[model samples]
Target: MSELATHETSAASFALSAEQEELRSRARALVEREGFAERSLEWEQTGEFPWANVKALAGEGLLATTIPVEHGGNGGSWMEGALVLEEIARACWVTAMASLGEIGVQSQALAAYGSDEVRAKYLPQIASGDLICSVCITEEQAGSDIFSMSTIATDDPDSGEVVVNGGKALISRGDVAGLFVVYVRWSQDPGMRPIGAVLIPRDTPGLTIDEGRETLGGEKLYALSFDTCRIPASYVLARENGFKKMLTAFNGQRCLNAAISVGLAQGAQDAAVAYVKQRVQGGKALAEHQGIQWMIADNEIEIQSARQLVWRAAAAASGGFPNRHDAAIAKVVSNEMALRVTDRVVQLFGGHGWLKEFPAERFLRWARYGPLGGGTPQIQRTAIAREVLK
Candidate 1:
């Protein structure tokens, strides 16, 4: 396919306005200059959350890219947010995981469901990256089935608090998140509506954050447990209709995941191309070899295709409301595309690719996480099927 053929027309049409472009450029320059070029490896080896890098991102206003300017955000569109994530992902995948999760969820949740006072209180600090929030939707038994969640939020008549119970698994940025948008079932009405969401500060009583696990990607995963954790009644995002509210924010999360995968695919392809042009065998650079050339070409084709899917989803999202059908399709396609492209990069490099000395192995590892996290590939397909059939 031609490069022009791959250009995302819809995305190109609603291209980031001049102001958005300026933000992207400025962010790109900062990451290139100040980001951890080599220390990412060390961070990964140590299984650390890369707080210093995240602090740098906050200083640059990336955390606020999607929030409105009135709320102290950079006030960029979802497309611009995607551009920012792409650049950050290119620099360090771990940082992208942390920054994107916070911005994506905060923008969607605060914009749609937050009460005026809620927005006024949290949006500014969150945009400034001074506050980091994580969505607590996936529970121990039910990963994607919101209706099947077992976490409980009981109303305490005496204290006028909602007492929370149960746990969340594999939560990204779990340990370090300063705020949590928790999904829980009302004990008085577990079957009445299935589940509800509550926004709780990290310091809420009876809340425990266990050490994060070692996931396939360098994700800092945490398991959260609530033992009669009491949050003010005002902490409830919306009493009975919390599932709908969580879904609203979830749409943006899926789109952001797609964007990150697209960036990872592109980064792997670029690295492979550079490596091919320099690594010679049989008296000629690997780029001259038919086998290597074919691999590089295929990677390029898939990367661009993935990029279009991502941009299309971003364009739809930027338009005030994203088409969930398109977003699901984009997530599935981009996740699969990244897996293919990164695996090919690993193949092209032969033995060297398997070694940590080269980043291909790391890219391949992180690419696998794309499908597992943010709803599995199986869940995505089911969602797309439901939307298409409906």
Candidate 2:
């Protein structure tokens, strides 16, 4: 066999343990019981975060599964976490996104870098879904180029605090987050270490949450502004090499993001298949048509391919931080694959796909974010190329 084939065979040999499978089964059951397909529309209309679902996931031990056992988590691997996210996303992208905050990059960052006191206080609450955390990295001018971020956090020696100033836009779950992991430039001097992240509470003085911006996916994206917001110096995550640490943790986010994309595509495909099998056209079901079969086949092929890429990336990062190059490649492929698959699903549904009465259109809308969030496809490709060239 060739090298690529051997790699695929080896990867295929890897299987989930019984415990992981049980976790996946429980998560799937919860999503089915919740009937998120119907409720997702309600949440979109009302612009709510679906706290009930969050609590439900927490009760099932699905939230923050990747957090270490020493820190009140299940001590699960990244693969297990991705599996949970996939099932949740298959139900509703909104709930999936909300769950990501608890189990994705921000939570990992706190677990990996937060002081012992900070971890003891917050990690349990996060794993229990009693608290929500938001990652504040994308600024008005620094969506793709994070180093260009203008937010600054300066330390005060006398007060033993840090004064934070600047704003973040397009932050997911920012409006409802109890904790914010805000990234900022720590120094003005050119040679000094410039980037760092600090924990800021929602009720911190001088911090303001602006009106929510409606994105293509209908999730409420908020802008957070910090005007001389002073937080205790002890809240600092990594003062010197904070940006590097954050970037490393973000590889986990990319893997989970890919899982969400794959799940959304799978959900859209499942909905389309169900619809086509029942809907009669010219005295035959839509599924009986060759054109429809071709579309369905194409979607299935891409979905399976995308899923393998996600699993590979997740596995690579199971023991420690994710392999940056693999994570970037998986993110780019899965994100774009979801867009293509969801678009085909919409087309397969014909007029009903465009109508809000069905879920296909919503899947298409949700898939659009896959490329934009967790670093754009262009950014992922750039990073991948850089790694390859080096």
Candidate 3:
């Protein structure tokens, strides 16, 4: 038997801890109570940020689980955060992405590398959902190639401020973010240490947030232009080794991104199963068809397998340092798995699947984000190959 098959037969192979299970249950209940499915459609159509949903999640202590307790967080493990994301994404991928931004990548970087003053000022607000943080890394010329980014942040010794000038594309929730952790080329000198990160407030001068750009999922995404934007020197995260630090924080994000993919696939599977059991054709329920049964069976197997990979990466990340290679592998598999599962679910639903009211089509659209965001499947594959070859 395959390793995945053997593990599935074991009772404890995919079991969550009691606390983790409770967290999942509560998060699921909250999403249901908020009418996430209905709201997700509304938000998608309107292109509005879900502030009320974010506040409700914060009230449930589901916003900043990975931040330390002293920083107004619950001090939860990465596994717990991933569990919450999975439950939330099962209901609404947009809201799940928002939660990931607040708690996963940008927030983790600030907590780990931000100055004490920066942390004290922003972390609590983030935990409470008063402020949303966005990470600015992808530029017009540097989608997957971080080193090719042309956005530069020059230090002014006389002015005691950093002048940032560049544009970032495809930034999630850019319109709603109160703060942004922007990655830029800090120096023109020849060296790998020329990159740096800085925090820029949304209202800072010379910072322009463009109109929202429509994606396959119809979520609110924007491009930012910083034309000689200036912020205090203290806002500088790291003048050197900024890229490495940012990448380290991004490993945790990759895990959460994988969890989102798994959750979305699971959601699609559940909807398909429920529909098949109720919809009858040829004087019999759709679920009674052997071909339909095979489709459902395949979905279950793939979802379980992808979920295990997500959990493994999250578990590895619970330690101080995340395993980059593990994160890359999990992300590549879960992302592709989500696209496949959602497509299968759409097939299972037949003509009704294409309708917006059924949610299969919506899930399919959102599933496209998995392979493209956080990191592309090709990029993850390349990273994994490099690690293994070394």
Candidate 4:
């Protein structure tokens, strides 16, 4: 508990401790020094992976924050990881997303559930930035409804291997990842009991990655086809009944996703503030006008509120993964909050906000990712409602 930076305000405010502040500062400095903010959109435009951003974050020990220290990582709490994500996102949403591919759901599932052989072989490499992981979950029928997912994995007892066949859509980092954390169904049953996950290295014989589709954030989403992709049986991360466990893993993911949303909104607000104070309207700085001031005030209020929700989700995970309820509410609030805040910032920037050269549009695009990335706000609301109904 002491590791988390708690505040005096209502015991809910997520105030930064000296160490957390330094960690946040370290992430910000790395982004600034690398010119990540300036070159943030280059990855999408050039269709290149942000390897430099990945390497820089990996070099600074930020990429390995979610993995346990025993695995050659920082063993930081969810809060620490959220802090790093928020700061990096504030500067460059692209870099922050790249960082998430390392420090987010796939890394978490592999670290928390992978077999000893799998963990030993990959965790060190993952911590060192020598390997990257992509989580394969969504499919044509399976974005929010896991029951509709068609990806399947089966045991081949005689071969000492597991075989997988099915396709995944909208997979992030598929082009660059060395490993894939695939969500699969072990049985045709119509319930969570049949759900499980497995790990397949990128070089596996039967796996094929399609040319990616460019996204609003400039990162590409890929389609993956596993034509009887087979790997050692040891590659299984979770067997039957694993969906419940992985849901726990995803709780942290929702928090980090929310953290990134908060960052994008805050970044937009920051940009708006600088612009408003300088850009004149009616012979006066925009900041001098009461209307502009209200916008700024509204942005701050929303940003602060979203940050606290994200932090609460992160901090509550100290006991382990956050309970689904907290993660759901936080995710819904933060995701929608980002849309409102960034939209306001875009309005504040007026004409410049529509241009690619300005950070405003980038932040806006980045903010759009939050609600869809972890889980849609609708899905989160359903989860929240489930808790409320109970």
| Lowest lDDT block of 10, candidate 3 | 1-10
Error at 211, model 3, angstroms: 1.2
Ranking by lDDT: 2, 3, 4, 1
Q: Give Cα-based local distance difference scores for all models.
A: 0.77, 0.86, 0.86, 0.84
What does the lDDT read for residue 201 in candidate 4?
A: 92
Q: Residue by residue across 98-192, what tens digits does model 4's lDDT show? A: 77857877777777888888878888788888898888889988889877888899999899899999999999888889999899999888888
Task: Write candidate 2's Cα lDDT for 37-117 as tens digits.
Answer: 779888888888889899988988889688778878988878888889998998799999999978778878888888888
Query: TM-score, each model?
Result: 0.92, 0.95, 0.95, 0.95
- Global lDDT for candidate 1? 0.77
Candidate 4: where are CA atoms >4 Å away? 1-12
Model 3, span 220-280: residue lDDT tens: 6789999999999889887776678778888988988999998899889889989999999
lDDT of 1 by residue, 197-227 (tens): 8888898888889977787666678899988
| Residue 208 local lDDT, model 1 | 89
Model 3: runs farther than 4 Å from truth?
1-14, 189-191
TM-score leaderboard ranking: 4, 3, 2, 1
Of candidates 2 and 1, the better by TM-score: 2
* Clash totals, every prediction: 0, 0, 0, 0
> Worst 10-residue stretch by lDDT in candidate 2?
1-10
What is the TM-score of candidate 3? 0.95
